[model samples]
Target: MKKKLWLTILVLLMGGVNLCHGQSLNTTAAEVADFDVQSATSNMQDLKSNLDEVVSQLYSLDEKERGTDNAISDKYRATRKEIVNVIQTINQTTDTIGEQLKKITTYKKLMLLTYKDIQASRSGMVDTKQYIEDFSNFIYKLDNKLYNENTNTIDDLKLMINSDNIPLTLANDSLVQSMILQLNDLMNNFQQNEETQLETIKKLNDLKTRTKDTIEQYQTEIEKLQQKKNYLLQFMKLYQNDTRQRQLTINNFFESTKGVYDRTVELVKDIKKWVYKVDFDMERKITALNELENDNEAYPLAWPLYPIEQIQTYFGDINFQTEYGVPHVGIQIKAGQWTPVYAARDGIVYFVADNDEIGINRAMIVHTDGYVTIYQYLKKTVIKPGDTVRRGQIIWYSWWEPGTRGAGFISKGANLTFEIFKDGIAMDPFEILDASIVKDKEALPDGYQIKYLRDKYARPIDITNLELMTGTTLAKRENQFLIKYGVGVYKQVAFREDAVKDTNIDKDMVICIAFAESTLGRYLSTNANIGNVGNNDRWDRVPFTSAYGWARAIPVTLNNAYLWAYHTINQLSRYGNKDGNIYASSPINWQTNVLKCLSQIKGYYIPEDFPFRTGPNPNINNPTPETITFGETLTQ
Candidate 1:
């Protein structure tokens, strides 16, 4: 019956304990321990009662001997006194044991509570430490970015701050607002990041303080419990070793409740296991902020692929519309048909899927930036989860071409699709990787036409949404392989002579820009948006009557009139399209691509391992070759 009662009591107490942990641990471990100890009070009382009964019987025998002391009073007076004294001493021992058991129960209660409290303290400590590390790393990266930008542009920033670009009237209010929006995006993100760091620190400090206090409290309770237990154990041993019968009875009692003792051992074991198993999630909490304020593109994370690679597609902006849904959340970089992709930073590989449902192999590695990088469409991957990789280790190689059924066709041909994620939220990889390194506008084949450009793009018939400009303006051509303009004819064929006269803008720059803009006069649109130098915002065109008219308006006329003077304030090197997307932030890729293409235009070089030589996609064969490598410079 007592065993059943103990089990019921223990079950209820444990239920409350589990409940406490679940519900923010509103009830402290101390409280729950005290409640459980109450169940044993009745058992202790019963044991005391039996002890008292045994002592009372010994007193009754002594009293009976005293009753017969009339005649034998003189003779047995000493014996009677001895019996009374012995009985008195026996009663005192019983009382002492009763008190000791009371204290023992309290000590046991305390030890149980201390065990639970320590686990809680440890959990809080680990959680707080992880959170501190996460926030620190995030804030450090943000600070680094700010330092880089400020150090480089402190003078320019000061000048801009002092300059009076504001309008007295509302005529240029929108323009000023747009400029503010562009600059403030970074500042606001920085401020928010700092505020998050502050909040994280507060949380970390509170948790640390709580953990420390909990440990101190548990230590005090345990010390008290241990001292009391030591005294109580010594007191109990006196009765157990008093006589053979007493020893036998105590032993039997212990044996009877042996199951309860075993259960308690198991309970302690369970709590130990829980302490080991129930780990707090160490995921970075600053992940959301990282995505929101990814203005720190110069985060020192190198590109997975370098100079030859180009970012074919960007994050967000899927379906060519900015309405809703981020279907494509990362960028794709084309390194070549068969080139190795490197790790962005030093980290461990966490996922590797070979011949997955996507048909292409893929790998995901956790980078030091607290984000996971996924490289898909891989032909070969060597590392697996938990394998450490260096910053520039070749983690995988790109496939020959995009998977037929899986990824289908990558925009810039056989390429590696790279993605960065933090706590399941996808981040823009280009924010860390150099977008220009992967996307050099100048690395295009000059004097070459992209064949099957018609087949590659959907026909005008499928462009049902072409509402404003709906008329069919089919292109005309004389030669399909070489330079061919539409039936519209040339308005002004003054490209080479004009380019030579304007020494500030080289022929190579002209050719590279023209080729890169619209695939050497064959854009995706059948209308041939050859000179993709249209509206600064949309790149939408005022359609040209002839290719020469388009070239004359942008490259020839625009350069001569305003842009191409090397000594002038409006140098073409720093000049971008009308909207001012600078082409010279990091000019290695641009200069290299342009110079290489210039060599090709001069029949100077060609790579034997070119992928597009004989397909419907003809090589830009306007007498162009790949004679020069990137390091070579063209002397003007």
Candidate 2:
């Protein structure tokens, strides 16, 4: 029994040794399969990386090639045509290669080496398909990018050639040449990388270079053409004798070239902006140019009068005084009585009347130049309402009468009043008139001739208060001489008349008053207590001390005159003696009454001291009375 048991133990141990050797063989097989799978994965990765690098380099070369002269010239165009013709061939080759790659059975071998991992085979097939599609998409993108960029570059070049004022410079030509060279380099590089012939690319580059060189030569010739054009312009300017012809040529040049020049500048600006990725639109610039070209024209000046006769009165100072104690502010012409009055220029007749209430019937014409001509003291108007008249065309007839007021009143002789205005303001008519036709006849009246009468006796009229007396009431003072020889009343009448007539009292009446009052010599008071007569003190006391020949009486008398029958009947009212009660007791009463009467007549308002005089003490409140006398009428 012991011998049998020992034999069984030996058999069991031998069986265990065999089992250990089988297990070692299985582990060694697993390690070998794992190493093979790792080697295959690394190989596939390296191939894909190599393919990606090639595609990247090809894409860069294509981009550079597109800007070459070959791309834009006949060779480039022909090459493109060839490429297009062989597109199907290239595509077929690509497809065959793809199919072959797909059928590479290396995946199965790698799977076997990895043992029974079914998922590894499926993963390998997916990776291969993905790589194929990525390469295909990359090639397609490169072709499209090159084709579009080349096409666009050609179009841009064409546009540049057609634009106006394109400068032909070495720098510009050099750009085209450089692009051609770059394109040639790109083609060579592309061939080397892809192992393909760029025969079409080379031909296209040659053709483009030739075309660009020809264009540059033509641009250089254009410099000579421009010089010739400038010479012709200079010749025309020098030899052209006819002013009208010369003017027309200048106008035409400006009108024709201005639009083109401006447009060219704008176009170049937009092209630069586009190159730099700036936002711009060409349509707007084109529209603006068209508008400018259409509206370019010259404005011509209009002559005031055609065949202008001698200017009867040039604009400037005239020898005439107004009833308002002011000198004539504008020019006056002396046309013969009953002479035909014509329009100065083509314009609308703004006014026409048989009477302006200041004695002259006037017709005023307003021209487009903002100038107006007034033909005064007209007997009759030929033109009616809204009548348009041409220069030098008769519109009315001049009428002159003795003892008329303002512009029509002529102390020297019978004459018509003519006046001119610019922009509603009076200007010297002589400046605009034809000097040859209107010979400078007489010098203007001197400043001394415009002196006022009241300037000698009392003082200057208070301009600020003249409007107030129009509505004030009055009371009559009790004095016999004040009622009769109270020159105050008559003097007031003259003052009011002078104010209304628009004449300077200083020029028209001051000198006369001085002669009449003190024989133009200084007067001294007989009583020392009264102060000097010609000085300020005597004049101050005269109002309260005497009812007649008083300095204060001057303004009071002038105010009373406006309320009297003299002014109220002959001047203010169309009907004689419209109001009967006309006397006033004081200057204040006279102002109040005159104001009330004037207000009733025309709703006119008078200033606070309408009839008051301007002086060192114009507004003194002393309860004084004064008087003044009327002198003979004086002419400016």
Q: By TM-score, who's the top model here?
A: 1
In candidate 1, what are the lDDT values of residues 449-549, reduced to their tens digit? 13113211322112222222111210111122124321222211223324334222333344455554554565624243453344333334456555544
lDDT of candidates 1 onward, in order: 0.39, 0.34
Clashes of each: 7, 63
Which predicted model would earn the best lDDT?
1
**Candidate 2 TM-score over all chains jointly:** 0.21
Off by over 4 Å in 2: 1-324, 356-358, 403-412, 439-636
Runs with alpha carbons beyond 4 Å of true place in candidate 1: 1-298, 320-326, 356-358, 402-412, 439-636
Model 1 has an lDDT value of 0.39
TM per model?
0.24, 0.21
Error of 2 at 521 (Å): 72
- For candidate 1, the per-residue lDDT at 444 reads 27
lDDT of model 1, residue 329: 60
